[model samples]
Target: MSDVKDRVLDAAVDLFARQGYDATSVAQVISRAGVTKGGFYHHYASKEALLYEVYGDLIARQLTALEQILARRLRPADTLRAVIGDLVGSTAASAQRALVFWRELHRLGHERTEEYRRSRRRYHDAVQQLIADGQATGEFTAVASPEVVTFTIFGVINELPLWYRPDGRKQPAELATELADLVLAALEG
Candidate 1:
């Protein structure tokens, strides 16, 4: 993305998170981005188009993190914990965008939803592979199916934004380690 387009997308993400999709306006985005109406229109045909770009960027970032986790060679249990740690650790840096994506992007329709689903499936597949590895290696016990294991981890980590304020109570690394331990305990047979 060009600098101007990047600005527009960033502004849109913030506005969508704060005021919601319906409540935000193109004019507001333009103002936030310090771009003219013409510049905004040059980059995005409509507000929905801008939102789609934002969603695409977010999904790409997540897939990249998952790939990093998968590339690590370690014990299955260690790998699972490491992957969860990677997730939580990366999420801390982009928590704002992730939170916005989680909270609002579902308002998108079937086609966009399907695109997001595809990206998410790749992410889940990586995790599933790790779980299967764990089961195969016998280092980690598998009481539940890999799909179930994936879903459980998703359920917990995806909810982090609901209660994850950056107060002095817990640092990102601390929270991630705690979450990794909890997930490990649950997955272990």
Candidate 2:
């Protein structure tokens, strides 16, 4: 992305997360980004487009990470650990964007919303499949259904932005490690 486009996105995410999608205007985004209206239009077709980009970009990056992790072909437990670590770390790193995106997701148009849902479902399905595979192979105990376990892990990740603090004692890596440990322990039982 061009410097101008990056600025617009950063500004959009910050403003949208703070004021909200409905309350924010293109003019405010342009002003905060320090770019001209023309520059903003050059990158995004509309304010709605910007909103989509904010969350879209985050999910895109996450999807890329997921693919890379899967490519390693690690054992199921290791893969699950990597997935949890990546999810928690990324969510903590982009808490504001995550918070705003989750809160205002319904504001997106039907098509864009479906697109987001599909992306999320891919991630969800991958984790669930990993759990199912482990259980089937007897590598992991079937203490809980894969669906429930997947939801349990994701539930904590989704709520992380609410209490996660950048300035807090634990770094994202540390938190990820601890979270992965807990989930792995439950799965192993």
Candidate 3:
């Protein structure tokens, strides 16, 4: 992305997190970004589009991270642990955008909303599949259905932004490990 575009996105996420999508204006984003109207328009069609990209980009990067971790071919337990850590760390680092996203995601048009959901589903499905595969291999005991397990995992992650503090004494990595350990314990015995 161009420097101008990056600035616009950063500004949009900041403003959206602070004021909200319904309240933040295109003019505010333009002013905060320090970009010309033409420049802003060159990258995003509207405030809605920018909002979509804010969440879309975060999910996209997360999905990509999932793929990379899967490719490492670790045992199911280790893979799940790494994935949990990555998701937690990434969300904590970008909690502003994550918060803005979950709050404002419904504002996107049907098509873009569906696009985001599909991408999100891909990530969700991958995690569920890992659990199922582990069960099949006898690595993970069948303590819960993959659907429920996946739900529990994502439930904590999705709600993380509301309470997680990046500057807090407990960092993302430690929290990630704690979460992973709890999940792993349930699956193992």
Top lDDT model: 3
Which tens-of-lDDT digit does each residue in 94-169 have in candidate 2?
8988888888888899888899899999999989999999999998999999999999999999999899999999
Off by over 4 Å in 1: 41-43
All candidates: TM-score = 0.86, 0.96, 0.96
Lowest summed lDDT window (length 10), candidate 3: 52-61
For all candidates in order, the CA lDDT equals 0.80, 0.90, 0.93
**lDDT digits (tens) for residues 1-189 of candidate 1:** 789998998898889888998899899999999999999999888876777777577668778866776677767777777777777766666667677777777677788788888988988998898898888877667778899989988887787766777775988789878878877887773
Q: Sorted by lDDT, highest first, which candidate order results?
A: 3, 2, 1
1-189 in candidate 3: lDDT tens per residue? 799999999999999888888999999999999999999999999888999888777888899899999999999999999999999999998888889888997798998989988998998899999999999999999999999999999999999999998788899989999999999999999
Report the poorest 10 consecutive residues by lDDT, candidate 1.
88-97
RMSD of 1: 2.2
Local error of candidate 2 at 38, Å?
A: 2.0
Q: Which of the predicted structures, 2 or 3, would earn the higher TM-score when compared with the native? A: 3
Q: Which segments of candidate 2 are over 4 A away from where they belong? A: none
